[model samples]
Target: MEESTINSSILGTKEYWENLYQQEINNYLDHSDPGEIWFGKGLTMKMVKWIKSKSSQLLPDDGDQIKILDLGCGNGHLLYSLYQQGYTDLTGLDYADKSIKLVNQMASDLGIVNNLKTYVADVLTLYKSNLIPERIKFNLIIDKGTFDAICLNPDLDLNQVKSDYLATLEAILFKGRSFFMIASCNWTKDELINMFTKSSQSFLSLYDEIETPQFSFGGSKGNNVTCLIFQRLS
Candidate 1:
């Protein structure tokens, strides 16, 4: 059976995010505006709270000890929140240079530049590239909407893209000791499970999940967003 696909959108394109972040940079410089939060501040905080609640289970020894990577970190809102919670080793990576610039600008303004590091790199091709050194591995990887954006790109082959993404995760995550948390509105809980776990080389397994508010219509209930956590199983 052919799997259903989400309609391709401009949101998937690098050019779109680059342009958006460029404008955000201008906005920040002129008006002191921070920029757009991908899912919203409330949801971002909710995610941080969830992590806080599970800190004992998630962190290696201390909150400052574990390295956290914000994949597709646009404007660094999520990392900023995590920083407030006392997670010191925070890195934000994005494909757009403007996105990195905006993150750096915000970090500088907040005087948290030393706590956060922003880099420009494509997540999809990251595993194949030497941009992020092999010696570096993250304890926690958070993806707010990066996978959704990757899936929405019209030009790419979905299967290959997903393979590359999972491969990248396998490469960067601290083997047998790391966790990956992702929040998505584009995929259902089951669909996401199938997508990540079905691959033959997949080393990730479902760990825990957080439920969002559900809406009812026509005697059916469904959530507008899905948040899930996965652990790397070696």
Candidate 2:
């Protein structure tokens, strides 16, 4: 895997994230604002609905048995929305401590603190790290713009980071039975597809995709966001 075409930016640095989340924390305390919602509030609900529909087909029997992990879960809005829809077993991970703190505060405010657990863990260092317990394996894992942020890191090799991400996914997800869904605003559909499928240790297969709104520019059509779902093969 080579570097992503996306240019490096400050958004890739942990320091940038910490400062952003710290400001969000201040705003949350002062004005009761829940902070940034990533792409938008609507996208959060859209992801929640998509997960609900897929879990029905995949789990079928007991929704509680399906454990889900949100990679780079900023402010934990997605997990919070999922909890509202009756998905209880959820875990969220973010590298910034302020991000985790804000999420914990939000969860505590809603009195659903026990429903979703959050931690401060960097995705690039997730494998073999003690941040998340080793025994826990998720049935469904999701990412909303995390990989895009990672690819923006000018310090680390994007290819190595992508590999580390996939390796982390392999470690935490149930083999052959788990699903990974990602929504990205930066990468094209084809670029994202090749990133996962063309890896040297590829074990993921395209399961399905969600249709997002499209925009036309200069007579060329493109999506504002791309949502792809993949399953780990045995």
Candidate 3:
């Protein structure tokens, strides 16, 4: 494993995100915009569309609850977009209070407050502590930039996180045929796949992969982002 230069000592702590989300909420209020474009809206659209493409297996019915969960759902933009697509059972979880508050405000401003749910709870703790019961009942889970930040933690046990993630998904995905879509800028396509294949179980397996739109970097095409899709099989 190669070391990266991220403030794990800080980022791995709850205070880090609380402070960050506070600033983000301030920006949203002052500038009429949300902060941080993880992989950009284009990548988010690509993910949602790809899931929609697998409608027969991943979706319920049009305008019906699909029981969606958005992990580390900053500002609730992703949740808002899913609501626009008619996914009713949409929930957003974050460790920061401001993140949850902003998402709730966003939902209200968009007139979908009743359709979307937002909670302020540490997601990493979900593996052991069931702070939110709804955490284990999602049919579709979307993560953008959450794992990237998590993997940066220096004390991280790579395989343990994998096991915990799998456990949480298996517990919640009442809809057996569920999809977990993740977009990340820190990991390569191969690295993400290896994270699962190297620690395989029958519970969740890789379903597909999508390369985020690339850009010219160092005189060659480079994709700083990638989307990996996994399906709950047990």
After superposing candidate 2, which stretches have Cα over 4 Å from the reference?
A: 1-4, 60-64
What does candidate 2's lDDT look like per residue over 110-196, in tens digits? 999888888889887898687788878888899999998988999988778888998898888877677899999999888888988
lDDT by residue (tens digit), candidate 1, 64-157: 4778999999988899899999988899999999999999988988999888877799888899899888888898899999999999999999
Q: In model 3, which range of ten residues has the least summed lDDT?
A: 1-10
Q: Which ten residues in a row have the lowest lDDT in candidate 1?
A: 56-65
What is the Cα-based lDDT of residue 79 in candidate 2? Answer: 88
Which one wins by lDDT: 1 or 2?
Answer: 1
**lDDT values, one for every candidate:** 0.89, 0.86, 0.74
Which candidate leads in lDDT? 1
Which is better, 2 or 3, measured by lDDT?
2
- Model 3 stretches astray by more than 4 angstroms: 1-10, 60-64, 134-136, 200-202, 215-222
- Residue 204 CA displacement from its true place in model 1, Å: 0.9
- Give residue 5's lDDT in candidate 2 (0 to 100): 74
Cα RMSD for predicted model 3: 3.3
Best by TM-score: 1
Residue 66 lDDT (model 3): 70
Clashing pairs in 2: none
